[model samples]
Target chain A: MREPISIWCFSGVLLFIYGLLIFASGLWELAHPLLHPPVLHQLHAPIWWGAILTVIGLWYLIEFWPHKRASQPKE
Target chain B: MFPATNLWMVSHLAGMVAHPQSGLIAAITPSGMVRLSPVDLIIIAVYFVLVVFIGFYLKESSNTGEDFFMAGRQMTAWIAGLSFVSANLGSLELMGWAGSAYQYGILATHWYWIGAIPAMLFLGIVMMPFYYISKVNSVPGYLQLRYGPATRALSGITFAVMTILMSGINMYAMALVMKVVLGWDLNFSIWVSAITVAAYVALGGLRSAIYNEVLQFLLIWAGSLLVPILGLIEVGGWRNLEKQIIHNVGQTGYLHMWTTLGHFNTNPMGVNWFGIVFGLGFVVSFGYWTTDFLVVQRVLSADNLRSARMAPILGAAFKMMVPFIVILPGLLALSVLPFKLVAQDIAVQTGQHSFNEVLPLMLVRYCGPGLLGLGVTALIAGFMSGMAGNVSAFSTVWTYDLYGAFMNKKASDEHYVKMGRWCTLIGVLVSIGTAYLVQHAASIMDYVQALFSFFIAPLFGTVLLGMLWRRATAAGGFWGLLSGTLTSFGLWEWVERDPSALRYVALSPDAKAMAQDIFRALWAWVVCVIVTVVVSLLTKPRPVAELEGLVYGVSPIPEEHDDHWYQRPMVWAGVVFAVFVVLNVIFR
Candidate 1:
């Protein structure tokens, strides 16, 4: 149970999504010069970093939350 | 060929040739045996014996995992205070500062005060309360309390990787200094120091590291102070050195603090004041103070919250004194020896290896013999303490946060104690590989900063949201972490490709400035807090207990949680902030 759970998190579907965006941005830069050439390389940067921050945000929302108010006590 | 020859025009022409200013060039005679005598060997042996003896004396008390990690969690403010400063003030500052001051002109000193001094103050006061009250093993472990097991485990692995990487860099950086100063073989120093640090750290954990840190701190301060004093006298006093530098550079504004600085964004190649502060100083100072486990473990082990808070405060106090030792010597080195010359001297002194030769080269040429040995020993002391601190934290994290938390939460104190030693051994071995690989890698500081950004930024998000916002969920933590990482790195990669973004990245002329800026942004503690706070406000609220912990402290599990500051955490946090601000103003 623990092994699978940890692995799923590491693979991180969202991280992949961000990586794809960066790849696209890089490709975009190679094809078309937008703004300065320097600015173009910068375009890919935010996706992965943004993805990283988003993941952190979601985790904080989940962990500190109290267990849903019980319908009936376990006891 | 020209109409008239003015000195400033001559310098400006030379500056055009170099494309900025006249750079330093090294003067050295290579192909000679190191000055390391049997007396030097004896000095090393005696230092080793004392350090090891301290480890053994402290080891019996380190019978439990808790004792090994947090010194039975009985640490006081002052000990934690000094150890923190000692860990940071190392070969990096010594070599990097000298190298930069020599090459870049007067801009190096500005990098220290503006980039690090304030960041240290803000982090020391604002973040200390959380760590003191929460009492976790690694900075990531704090995340587990706020997020979930997955985030905690991720934090653990990354923290371990980052520490080992830094240890490897430190290993290489230290050996480089030795090679330059003592004229020893680079390979020889690296191999010997790696073994020495591993052996000592594997035997004793944070206790040994912290205890030894007290000694290193003293040596670092003494040797650092001694070097400049002697060098100034040797060069016919500060008056001559200062005059020569002003004449050579042809611009005295570099000496002025109020001079606005620029960075990659504005300058493309260098940084100015804005970049130094928001970029280098704000980012790196916060990351190290708030997130890095090597320093935090000392505070977390404190007897109570009061002691923990004081550690960073005192460390910052000491940080304010750094320019005296590291920065000023670098400035002195700049005036006396050009960087190019220093580089060549380092090569001759350190056998023509890479950057490792810079510091030791300066030491040998500049300082006299007795002081030379003392400075060399101090370098060793600085490095050993750093290696010890990292290995100690690594061992504790592996044993408690992972081994205990996952494999055997129910294990006895005895089992955990034994596990701690094994953990440290594993951690040290990992560092050996990292050090071996790091010699060939890019700038050690940059690589370390990059690795840290991956974990520390996200973990910072988890904890901040957990503390400041009640609605922060495990899911929220997960999302926030992912978001903040992408944001900071987005900034990082953008800067990397454009190079102009480097202005925002480090915004300092020196590696330490760059390191500090990148350190600050990579973690992006501010981004984490702001995002977590605003996001949580828009979301639902957590139960009262969770909110209470956000305000107060991580409450002990299996209780309703009373009196421990969870309910009134805001009051305490406000107090920490006010004190931090006051310290900054007075110190500045």
Candidate 2:
């Protein structure tokens, strides 16, 4: 009954991509504080948010990897 | 030559000082909304790309009519539940009710709780068994089963028209927000959102729409959670927010829910407790949560009877908490954000007491660039989820119930699937046109509520009677529906004909449009019930065999999958009821 694509798989991929972007942004902002506007220069919300996204994305990915593998052999 | 960055900053500061209030608050201008940093743009681009990817990804698997329209009946409880509530959590619900909370105070929470929970529980425990067991693909399809084709056609066409019009209203509402926040061209905003929704909906069908809705639910939560959290922190927590709001608004009633609701004069809602409990909580709320196809369609896509029934219960649990995300921002706006500045332009656009830019203003104040993009994206996600909900429901009803049933009954399933796609395209285009038409009308929230009173309230009455009463004849159903609809119109028209007439019913002169909507729904429900009962008794009832799976008493009940006592629907209902009482008592 497994479809070719499900919401969980794509949610993982997309969340991963989004997490990667936030993580990179957090690193970049932390490395070069002068480039960012003063309002955003000091806030660590991005770093924390990015870390949360990373953890969530990894969980979805780990959960989905086996399902994808199981369905691949049938295809 | 280009201006220096320093010079541009100086000019921006000067512009802020030139505003009515002298502070760092920038006047909402076109460039300010669109002038996202590189990181912000990248984030939004990623979101859109992922959304389109999800849409087309599911398209390949959806080959059959069932797959296209109903997700092949494979949705789990959480998916169905989330999509059910998310579909209802559209831009109108978020932006409109948030603004209502600002204007009407904590009493607006009534729409979230008392107005929703009881009816949602009713739908879950009592009504869904019939819907799932009867195996109707759409609500109109159910009508066709219960009352015959005449009732189906009437309900079908009314629902189809209402869905498209409501979809267009969502488009229009979103465009209004964009124009106010981003200063984007109205037509451009409408087309961008319309095209995006149409593309995904047409590509992947209901499955795609539901999947994206779940995603939007998460995004909305992620994006909006910070506003209340930060707002609470900035205001020194909930107690401080209450005190500051009272000081700023000069009213203690804004902090309490039921205390001021004793009379219209005492409440900011301008609605007495009787009107709040009966008009909204009973009639309007039941009419909408119990019967609206846009929401019911999500639950209908569930895998089995248990999932279908549990969907709304799960939805009700989540639904009870939504006021925190949507309404809290409005409450925060009353204290943390300056009223005079944000109210300047939105007041002109919406023709309301305060600016409806509560959420957007709060976002601007609290979020910096990176988080700002995520916040705005969440708002966009909300708008798109709503549009998708409307368009997808419209396409299904148009394809299965209207086009498939009436125009060509003998078509193949594949043919119907193709037709559904075409209808999705056409539905979005029609909504775009309707969005433009709605620009000249009054506020989006008021217009939407009035339409619900006219259409959904009556429809709910007919549906409630048909499901519970097997003796109810088809002739009774048809006439009851017709009478209920006409009565709502007649009452609304009478009020419009003489503006002073509302006072005769003890309505305040400055009562919000929602009050009138409540009264109209109450009267319409009464009319529908009366006409239906009177007509039903005069006609011969359908045979018990014909009513077996469709009616409450004669229907062979399905076995409960919930082997454990805690999993029972009644237990969940009781738990939800207890929590609702606790919330009311605490907020009261």
Candidate 3:
């Protein structure tokens, strides 16, 4: 049950990508002030994308919402 | 502009409110609250007396580990609900976030409207079913059942880290406030607040803490609520105050953080919509609402699962009401006083604190003594209740999870309870000491929450996969936990750490102006969840039988649940989701 190297790699790649995104975002910031999005646009841009992911994940969860509980477990 | 004498209970309370005409807020406290005034010291005495007495009152119940840890599992729904909400509110929320509200505007609390309230409700109905089906001693134990031991241990340890990090900062903050508001020596204030809270926590464990928290919560609320009411009256009334706010904001909505005006100066944490939703809303709310140990223990300790579920949901309602009392005054402080400090967050300050100085500057400058005492008492109550909750939660983690689980396995229930007392003593001392380390953090609010957020999200990955993924292997689960944490930390230090790193992403103009980098912190959560799941999927699955008990909360009694909560998660979820759409549409 110990974790595999893949999990770590997965984590590492994410960090790298986020760092990568930040690196990319830095290019954006360096461009200087742009128009502020409308209030709703301002709030939901991150949310809509995150929600898309979350809903997809949650959809996976709903399919097995009532999955049976196992009486036996690994200690 | 005439003040409303009806709600204006405290005299001179208006002195601190910001007004364009006025040069400064808290202008009356220009001289600073003189040393431990007899009135301030008396408030301390009354607080100790009531708290200590309650400690003894609940001592009989603390004779067992169950009593110490879960208040003997007999807590009523209302109390548990209130306690859950109150405990989650550390000193920082009142002093720090409120300050943010004051600096920014009312829209900051919008996170509660969209994010927190729904999440709490989701946990209420969605989680209660699973919780009722499984009778676990803790959230991690449930993780062990659904996921595997590796996942269990990972979840347990991560939660403990979260508790320590959060509790540690909370401890630091309360002491800092005491020093500032009471004008006591820093060391003395830290020790006093820590030791005082620890004593009651040790005396009766969660029960004592919970009960004391109720009193403290009410007191704090009274104090928080009093600030703006008194201020508006003193400013000559809301008409004048609104003028100041409209003047300060101009064209932009001052009550909202919607505008991209100066980014760094406002929303310093970069708590834009995404940060609020994903960082605080989804990641923080889901992770904490569903799984945080401090919150879970309170619910589990309740008399019934129904109450347990109701506690958080009810608590959510209470939390939503908070912006009215706490944040409004902060905004009022801005309009009445005019803004000076961006990072003027109370928790960020060290050495010199005058919490009483927040409201009393008005009393000292504009009002009289009688009202000041009442307002001061309320503030103290707010501070102490929050501090007490932290001390209590810390001891539970140390005792039940660390001490009883590892150090003293065979100790009888009585001995376990006694050990909890010792843990409380040590936990308090350490926390007080840890408070000193917090100021050194980048932004006490951002640094600690982000640290926890980076590490904690992987947990969501493991738990979700473990319960839902039949193919999820013990190996995968374990690996995911480790990898998730490593990835989060690695990203935090490497990419997000560089101010220039996230400088490239094309964001709204307002996003670019932010003082702190929000992208990196957001990425940490994303990466951790991804690695945990992928690794779990790629790795081997546990034997179905072995994974059985872990996935579902199976118990001998077939955990009883009311039919009422089970039928309507969709309704709740749908309503909440629709609101999200509407908020965007209307606000758009």
Ranking by TM-score: 2, 3, 1
Model 3: per-residue Cα lDDT over B427-457, one tens digit each: 6666665566654442444545546655556
Which of 1 and 2 is the better model by TM-score? Answer: 2
Error of 2 at B228 (Å): 0.8
* Ten contiguous residues minimizing lDDT sum, candidate 2 chain B: B1-10
Stretch of 10 with least lDDT, candidate 3 chain B: B1-10
Per-residue lDDT tens digits for candidate 2, residues B354-462, read: 4345666677666666677777777788888888988999999999888988999999999999999999999999998877776654344344545556877778888
Best by TM-score: 2
Q: Which regions in candidate 3 have their CA more than 4 angstroms from the true location?
A: A1-75, B1-31, B34-41, B165-168, B230-243, B257-272, B338-371, B436-450, B495-497, B504-521, B543-588
**TM-score of the first chain of model 1:** 0.37
List, in order, the clash count of every candidate structure. 88, 0, 44
What TM-score do all the candidates reach, one by one?
0.71, 0.90, 0.72
